[model samples]
Target: MYKDDGFDLVFSYTFPKCDLDGSYQAVQENSTHKICVDKEGSVLTAVDKIENKTLADAMDCNCLRANLIITSVEKPTCEVNGNYSPIQCRRGTCRCVDNNGNQVCKSSVCEVAEIDRDTLKC
Candidate 1:
């Protein structure tokens, strides 16, 4: 996604525009969406209502059009797995690390989380 002057030039993951309710294909000659993530990731609460479609056999096999809003990471206060852990984003993007430098999430950079008010953006 390219952001210039506050407007984000997202490949095909913006919202409303790229969101296609169920499944559809881009025209390519005119379609502005592209392949983003293929993993079974969850959309943030803020953008759960948005819809998207997928175009098969495009540039990449994992390309899908969806409006993905990044959310902030929540802190877990209870013991999960072994110690008190921070809740990680189920989208498989960001994970919560312990306060003591423990990698709580199984993903890579996707585990790094940031808190923006009540939302978690990874």
Candidate 2:
């Protein structure tokens, strides 16, 4: 409704903002990547493999831009630069993840005894 109310309303059906540079869109459930899209949410960039000369970077639903581990994006605590936090806690277990969100350092999942500890060691 930001447009003018005129006879052009019946002639054009597209939004200008959604047509240029595309619009930021949400990915499917359980998916780690968000995408830029058209008005109807069709992928507009070549980021599937991230090998093209076009756009390559993507932000996960968890606000993570570097790590894209399967089943790990959900309920994640991310760093300010979109890297996965070094330590994460969930389901009474805590673990360590690398910059790419992969479990690393040969560390085993640690069981948390106190629920009030914000910082966890793995």
Candidate of highest lDDT? 2
- Count of backbone clashes for each model? 14, 0
The runs of at least 3 residues in candidate 2 whose Cα sits more than 4 Å from the true structure, single-residue gaps closed, are: 1-63, 66-73, 105-122
Highest TM-score against the true fold, candidate: 2
Estimate, for each residue in 1-122, the C-alpha lDDT of model 2 and write its tens digit.
53554434445443323324564333321123324333355543223323321222433323342233346634667643243566766676566766556566653333343363355564
Backbone clash tally for model 1?
14
**Per-prediction CA RMSD (Å):** 17.3, 12.6
Native-referenced Cα lDDT, model 2? 0.44
* Model 2 Cα shift for residue 80 (angstroms): 1.3
- The lDDT for every candidate, in the order shown, is 0.32, 0.44
Residues 1-122, model 1: lDDT tens digits: 23555775657653422325543322121243333232332321111112322222223221122212223353333221112234433343345545432455565443543342124332
